[model samples]
Target: MTPHSIVPRYRCWSKKLKTTLYTYPENWRAFKAQIAAQYSGARLKVASSAPAFTFGQTNRTPAFLNNFPLGKVPAFQGDDGFCLFESNAIAHYLSNEALRGSSPQAQSQVIQWVSFADSEIIPPASAWVFPTLGIMQFNKQATEQAKEEIKKVLSVLNQHLNTRTFLVGERVSLADISVACSMLWLYKQVLEPSFRQPYPNVTRWFQTCVNQPQFKAVLGEVKLCEKMAQFDPKKFADMQPKKDTATKKDTPPKKEKAAKEASKPQEKKEKKKEEKKAAPAVEEMDECEAALASEPKAKDPFAHLPKSPFVLDEFKRKYSNEDTLTVAVPHFWEHFDKEGYSIWYGEYKYPEELTMTFMSCNLIMGMFQRLDKLRKNGFASVILFGGNNDSSISGIWVFRGQDLAFTLSDDWQIDYESYSWRKLDPDTEETKTMVKEYFAWEGEFKHVGKPFNTGKCFK
Candidate 1:
């Protein structure tokens, strides 16, 4: 059944108890629900504050499971026995006619901006923010790409807000509350002045939204990020639980080991001390000998390929700093080698799972990070096409050998299995067009029939 069908009408209950919200204390979804309740003059209570529910353990009980089958956080159960899940739906039910749009068109616009916040803003914001919060593992390449994508999203919002104060109407609405709450972590944790300077309109609108009386009540004294936070390896390591190091059943008891140590003769202790002085020299020799024997023995894949005049680093520098069509594309063709290297087109195997543009872009960034070893011998421009819930991923790859680079090394094989690859003939017009379009980061992809939302470069 559809989600809306299960959400009973707000007018169905004449007498309503304080809505019980089940979520973590700092959950953004729950924050959205709280703001909506404040705006609509509705009573809401935290489930953890009530006697019946504990934060983690209570949510997993059979009784709680019967009420909310999914058992996801930010769930709601009204005093009238009505239930709802999904933050957006709960927020909508809590809102009154004024917060929700007054007219049909306005309501549709409100929904559009809410969808935009979910599909465009949240993915990249989470990628950049979660690592700093120690929620996800950090990777340098993925973080950089996420920052760039966030800039684009903010630019769009900046332009739109330049003409209008609120996202949909003259005053605060559910749209403003939803979008601002989605961006709460980003503004408070990562969007420092220097990084956000370009989008002054977005910054102003965000500040205005948070400063509203309703918003201030939910998110008190919002603090803008003074400096962008970076990933801390120590924090990431500390979050992981320590492994159990107790001795196994096959190991000897600690008491037997202690008794053996006490049994050593006093005279032999002095002799052992003398031997210990000489033992360091012997151990140093053994370490050196072991180092030579145990050194990495894997052969370099690029060793077999003949070296060409094309330097990947130089081309990348030109591609990045100069005009792609005029300078970079020309340089790439001039150094193109038909025999020593090959070009391939790669497509994601499961387009159905790609629901957001920023997330699709992250998938590409993650793949590039896993393929770091290929930086010296390979280059690629993978692009995310279309909008939210209807998108595809494809890229053009240049490898040092005729075969795919992933086949050359196991290090590059992590994410390659998720994509289908086809070797393109460099001599064909189609191949040349694909290379120029993908590398230049512009051109109508007629085959996909979707605009390029974002792209990532490997190398």
Candidate 2:
């Protein structure tokens, strides 16, 4: 008897079992897995909502760690204990002959496009997309470079797809799937009508691929970006976990209740008696008052420094609301305070450790956040430089004092240690130019020898 006829029960059981995918919903990689399954005619179940499969939290569990040591998403496991991780591998495994490519040459081409998607497309695509999605800190130079890189990529794809319907062959293959998924974020988040106008062929091919039955089933109705997104600080702040400030059990009652008790004649007399007993000890300060007294006082570190007529905030407002090169920079030099405040050049000590442009921007953002106490006393334009996996952080700091404003407060101490600082002589032509360039977030950074990426303002 044939194996199918001899083992009907086993064959039926095997067909009934489905592959389980462990991944977060809305992930582009997960879309690949879903699309592959649809094309392959395989039963696939999402394990995202399973009770034991909470993202980040559950993924770190021992059980999950046993399956995926790296703890990355888009993992897969077949019914027979066959397991796989990495979105590409899982998608390739789940695909049929047509999707994987029918011939050896076709398969090799598919692999070529997949690698191209990862290397040529993803880095720049991510730099542009993640900021718009509020997933990463935005850098202007980085974003612009990414835009240029994307334009080049789209130009290549546009030329290739001029007559052909798909990437590798006439039929939809893994190459199409891989490249489409890579472009998904850009199309959905940053590629608005005008920005995508240059690549009509690419746009047509992308829309066609996404509209196919398998792609549609997995991606649903794909919404193209309406407007190019700008980074919003509030959105970034909202993503961070809020600190818990619950009151302690040992904390005293509210001041209103204490005042109410003191208002009572009987309680007033009792309080006076207690105070008399403790009079010998210098009258004890109220616990709250004592706590408040113990807190570090904010003093103007520039009190001893000379005062100038320049108003930093007024200039900052003009700089922000008007054109930088035309209005703000001119206004800055016209009213700069040399003796009252000092300009300093600050550079990150460990530029070698800096990887991922956005994360490096975050390091600057975190510094600014921690330096909130110095907002009134300091103004800075810290810019991130270079591309992904290779970058530097440097900025011009204008402080209320001759020394670093961070030195005046313990609260600002957290991030300043990472940087090496040098005071700039404000009277020099070079210092004037540096202040103008850094403040306006433009001009060549000759000292760093890297293109400016993005900048944060500490105001």
In angstroms, the error of model 1 at 319 is 23
Across 1-459, the per-residue lDDT of candidate 2 in tens digits comes to 321122101111124467899875567877887887777777899886548365655666788879887555778888898889888898888787788888999999998888778767876886677655544445565567689889989999999999887888667788988999989978987899998998899998888888887788888888898998777766544333334443544446686567567779988788898667545322212111222223345454555666678897677667655666788778877887777778899999999998866457547755764555465567778888888778888888888867788877655687888899999997898988898788767887788898776442222
- The local lDDT score (0 to 100) that residue 262 gets in candidate 2 is 71
- For model 2 the local lDDT of residue 197 reads 95
Q: Give one digit per residue, the lDDT tens place, for model 1 in 1-459.
A: 421122112222223577888875557777888988887777888764336554445665788879886455689988888999888999998888877888999999989988888767876776688668654456455567789889998999999999877788777788988999989889978999998999988887888888777777888888898999877767545433334444545457786577557766765887788576544322211111222222344466778778877787677667755777888889988888878888999999999999866567657765765555466578888888877799888889998889988988755676899999999998898988898898866897777788786543233
Worst 10 residues of 2 by lDDT: 3-12
Query: Which numbered prediction scores highest in lDDT against the true structure?
Result: 1
TM-scores of the models, in the order given: 0.57, 0.56
Error of 1 at 378 (Å): 26
